[model samples]
Target: MPIFHKISLRPEVENYLKQSFMNEEVVSASSKQEAERRFEALLIHLAHPPSFTTVRVNTHLASVEHVRGLLLNELEKQFSGSSVPVLQHPALPDVLLIPVTGPRRNIEKQQCEVIVGAQCGNAVLRGAHVYVPGIVSASKFMKAGDVISVYSDIKGKCKKGAKEFDGTKVFLGNGVSELSRKDIFNGIPDLKGIGIRMTEPIYLSPSFDNVLPSYLFLQNLPSAVVAHVLNPQPGEKILDLCAAPGGKTTHIAALMQDQGEVIALDKILNKVEKLKQNASLLGLHSIRAFCFDATKAVKLDMIDGTEGTPPFLPESFDRILLDAPCSGMGQRPNMACTWTLKEVTSYQPLQRKLLNVAVQLLKPGGVLVYSTCTVTLAENEEQVAWALKTFPCLQLQPQEPQIGGEGMVGAGLSPEQLKQLQRFDPSVVPLQDMDTDCLGDAKREDMIWLANKDCIGFFIAKFLKCKSTEEKVSRK
Candidate 1:
């Protein structure tokens, strides 16, 4: 049962999305009515998280089986006797999938209510405990250890520190409060900790708060797929543009057996620090994070003596992963998006700028993978179409696993071209209820299929730069 309403979007933004679904290519393939239905389904699914929680094992430190065992034991303790199954991905060796059981309608609501911010509520749906900073309001007399029903202020109507909230709120099961109203609202410096311990969450997924921190990385399924598609090799020089938080950067290094040099760049200083921190945590010494703009990363003049950092010479990298910053429309478990159409459509230029840099920095025969966690044609397929025309030496390459659906239509890409790209469309795959009773090989197969299709909306396009004839002649 779909517990929440379709994700609330601005009127203009909704119309923009509607046109993308009802585009001529889509309408010709499937009727307008069917297109509308899928778009509606997408909205509903966005409000919910993926059917399974995906984790990427750090194969450099431990084997996938070893990490799976550790995760199984940890989840067993977390669930408290509820038998949870942890299955390894059939296609992806370094990935593990755990089914997320959900929208449990049986949990009774309580009289005393606690309201949390929208972002925190979304995290709760994905098995995150309510932290102190996310709490918005509590009952007047609510104290520590009080069992209260938790609700999300989806529309941002709940006043902070209010005694009661009657505005639009979605119930997110019940939890025992870990702090009183005074403790949360008190003018304290950095009150960072769990505010509510969810005893009966609506969605029963394991909370990975420091569980197997070194061996397992809590990543979305599509994200793990991106690193594999790049297929970084040991001893190769790779560049990761917009690689903040460094999930893919570390994964790429790990895949290379920590022998390659991965130069990761992000514009923000704090985000670069976070990238470095994640690299340190995962024990990936090959990754070097820098606070530099990827667009201006190319160096026209050579300095007498320079280190291996950005402002690199042209064609310096063997491979590049341009996971461009996007509008993030494809992220799941989102209850509401209050962005204007301008903000929603602002990523295309930036993505193109990054893509140009990626092409310039990649070696003639190197591979470049462009990806985005967005579902828009302008930022995804359209960009691919533009790239193919702008760069004559680049050719679309087939993805290795090809687990996701083909690229979306209406981008002027042919049938063969679309097949080369991968788009993880959540709407096309209906959300299935977890079959806990079935624990056989059949169940494992079903879980793997669901894990691939029912993931966050994502887009990936792989391109290989062909050596120019002039360059070949010069070499000869």
Candidate 2:
């Protein structure tokens, strides 16, 4: 059963997405009813979390089997002897899957209620405890250790420091208050810690907070696929443009066995620091994180010498991964989005700028993978079509272990070109009500399939840069 409401988007934004679904190319291939049905399904799925939680094992530090054992032990302790099966992905060797037992409808709601912000509500759905800053309202006399029902201010209608709220809200689950209502909002200087410890969440997934952080990274399934598709080899000079928090950068270093240099660039200083910290935590020594805008990363002069920093000469990198920053419309457990149509459509220009820089920095015959966690055609398939047209030397390459659907229509891409791109659309898979009684009887392969298709919407396009004939002749 779909417990939450369909994700709320601005009127204009919703209309724009509907048009994309019912575009001429899509309607030509399928009936209008089918397209509209899929669009409606997407809206519903966006407000719910994925059916499974994906964790990427650090194979460089420990084998997948060893990590899996440790994770199972931790989950046993976390769930208090509840048997939760940990399954290894057959296609992705370094990835592990855990089923998220969801929408536990029978959990009793308490008399007292607490309301949290939408972001924190989404986190709770994904197995995170509610932090102090995310608390919007609580029962006036609520005390610590009191079991209370939690709700989310989906439409941002809840006022801070309120004793109670009667606005648009959605029930998340039940949790025990970690602090009294007075302590949480009583003019404290630093009130940053767990405010509510989820005792019986609607979704029963283990929280990975401080749990074997080095051995496993709680990443999305599609994100783990990006690094594999990049296929970074040992001793290759790779550049991660717009890499922040360094998930893929560290993954690239681990994939390369820490043999080659992986230069990670982010526009923000704090994010660059986070990138470095993640690299250190993962024990990867091949990454060098720099705070620089990827758009201005190219250097015009050949004699400019900057040791291992940005503004590098053209063709300096053997491969590149442009996990471009996007509007992030595809993130799940999102009940509402406040962005206007302009904000949603603004990423195409920025992505194009970053791609231009990425192409300039890549060496001939080198591979470049472009990806985004967005479902918009402009930021995804349209960008791919634009890149192929803009860069004469670049050609679309097939992805390995293509688990996602083909590129979406309405991008002006041909059938063959679309087949080479991968788009993970959660709407294709119908939502199945969580069968808690049959959880133990579920097949591993069936669970893996559900995890793949029920994930957040994402897009990936890989390209191989070929040397121009003039350059080839010059080399000869």
Candidate 3:
């Protein structure tokens, strides 16, 4: 029996995605039957978390070996006597991977049930407790300290403060309720903090709530790969165009050893504030964040914006990272998505606009990395084709530590062009719940590679400006 249902999508969205996978090019490359199988597999894998919980060590302040020791000890205390081995990536030395033991056959479900939103349920599967705000519905007579079964309202049909929900719900194991029904629903000051303390989750992954705040960043495996591919050096100016939450921004600063300037830009004030806070927490001082639209980041007529602000002069940055905003259909443990076709297809124009600005802002002989967390060819492969044709200065460059496979074949890209792009497809390999108790070296290595390919669906394309080398900084 399957532990969870495949991700639910509306009929129109499903049909649209089917066209992308079963197009003439894809069907010609592989059989139509095989293309359908991969598409189905993509839906199945998206509904579950990856087999590993990946974290990046802040090598600027603490070495990877030191953080690994502290993290292993903490996992020991949490798992209590089970040998949960922490494996370091051979290609990525600063990355650590801990296997996520999952979908346990036996879990005691409780009679009292609590319903949480789909987003929160996904978080619980990835080692997060249910916060109070995520609670959508609770049983009528539920009280504090009550043992309850948690379910995700997968279709978003559950009403808040409801006694029962009959629409689609998936089991997420059992937990202890920290707040009573009245406390959560009727508390004058809206209730906050953890509402349910997970006891026996179907997926067994350690929660990184307060585990080495400065030393470790709870990041995905492919996300860490982006910074390493950017290859930021000491004292070189870099721009993180759509930086928010500071994952790549801080990683770039850390890679530069905090010696160079990192200009981070985001349009949202609150998100910029959060990324600034994250930079401070990680002890990365090189990142300077500003709330400005990246589409307007280029200064007009050789005029620069205020110093320490955005709208910098053209060819101002040695490197640029355009982590474009997309439909976000590639996130794992996502049970349902209620997006219309218009919303799903709206990212291409915006992505192109940002790409134009990014090329303008990048210095000659500079590197630019474009990435997205969506599975659509429009946002990923098609965008690559568009960028290549639109800008003669931008040339696709190879990536280091290429863990993901070649791009999908539906975007009219040639075999050589597809090979240069990296698309982390979870559907490439069948799902396997990892158990690291008695694994040998060979087995461990295989699992690590699977963990890389079986992660969330993502896309990355690196480019180098092959313009005049008069102003090029010598790369050592």
Candidate 4:
């Protein structure tokens, strides 16, 4: 099978990333040629999904072992009785991992083509079928149940309802059309549901469409680690800023055994609704979803706002999670990114605003975890450095179960300080060729470790509040 094309990026954005990876700290450790090679490899890895698909079990309603058994049975039924082991994580007992087989080269391309947007293409690569809303253009005479080749329009220039497209596209494999072109484009408003039933995809990742809705949450390897790094305790009030569609928020609640008050905040109403839906579907009741901007979350007055609402007084929570917004350049199977340089670098300031509030909201001796799903130095290490300097009360704490590598060197952090940070760099290891034969516990543990590093380009930094009062918020 041929390797995926490198993740397409604007020239200015690409240059900015290359400099971040090959800066003075990075160059001092290695030669310029080595740094450039690693940057190139990262771009390639970003265009492909990880070898293993990760999911977190809702331990509040089900045990990991019980959920694993059911998920394995589901996979067996879906894959025609082929054994696909659902492995439990050693450090994170509630997490499960499924191996994804991919880039199958032997499938013949069909004559009819269905074009989809870049975002839809990324979802297809990650085990989702083409949905009706994602359809960009289809064959002129395409009909339901007809075999059609699906392609991703990487340049975002494909016109909707066009008979054909001449823009740059990539073959994503073949599927049977579930709707006729006439029916799809025939003046139907707000059409929903799958448009293509994928019979053969280049990457054979499992599709969890309404499968074990309450038992499992399909998550990335690094994302699951963020909640664990927070280490929320039962009966303690916790906060999750920017927590819409709360993957981490739900995980935090589960970790606390649903006994704690988990306040989740997001700016958008629809996203907050999704967060509520996920929490309700997972049977996690401790999470309270709110549609409020996190930058304005901290209110100085205590009597003005009602309990269990946003704009709370400072030092109100035991632990806080700032899973700040980011450029999202690290997501896998991304055929292309059309963001300009300004859009790519616009998140650091917003992250700092949230971190400032996160620090104020964390109680003395409380734990706080800051994370992002991006690979920019300005958002990760540089943000960590700024937090430490700006908030003396906040000190970087060691992250347990350190599966990812240490912080990248370009950011001005000392070596020991960098060790406290976790950056899931996919380029640290090459793509794996899984061979499960004769696999013992030891071999399998080693294999899973490699998969952890190859999963996503994420970053996590844990901190502790050392001071109690605002005026006294200073570390010795």
List the global CA lDDT of all models: 0.90, 0.91, 0.89, 0.89
Every model's TM-score: 0.97, 0.98, 0.96, 0.96
Whose TM-score is greatest here? 2
At residue 473, what lDDT does model 4 achieve? 43
Model 4 lowest lDDT segment of ten: 433-442
Estimate, for each residue in 6-58, the C-alpha lDDT of model 4 and write its tens digit: 99999999999999999988987999889998999899899888878899999
Residue by residue across 1-476, what tens digits does model 3's lDDT show?
Answer: 34777888888888888899888999998899999999999989989998889999999899999899999899998887766878899888989998888787688888899999999999999999999999999999999899999999999999999988888899998999998988889985666799999988989899999889899899888889999989999999999999998999999999999999999999999999999988999998998999999999988765544765778877888999999999888888798898899998899999999999999889989999999988888899999999999888889988997988899887878899899999998998888855444343437778788778889989999999987332333442
Question: Measured by C-alpha RMSD in angstroms, how accurate is candidate 1?
Answer: 1.8
Taking the tens digit of each residue's C-alpha lDDT, what string does model 2 give over 1-476?
A: 58888999999999998998889989889999999999999999999999989999988899999999999999999999887888898888999988888788889988899999999999999999999999999998899999999999988988898999999998889999989998898957578989999999988888999999888888899999999999999999999998998888888999998999999999899999988888888888999999998999998776858667888878889999999999898898799999999999999999999999988888889999999998988899999999999999899999997989999889889999999999999999998666557677777778888989999999999999896423544587
RMSD of each: 1.8, 1.5, 2.9, 2.3
Best by lDDT: 2
Report the candidate with higher TM-score, 1 versus 3.
Answer: 1
- Give the Å shift of residue 253 in candidate 2: 0.8
lDDT per residue for candidate 1 within 25-108, as digits (tens), equals 999998988999999999999998899999999999999988888888898899887778888887788999988887678899
Candidate 1 local accuracy as lDDT? 0.90
| TM-score of model 4 (CA atoms) | 0.96
In lDDT terms, how accurate is model 4? 0.89
Determine the backbone clash count of candidate 4: 0
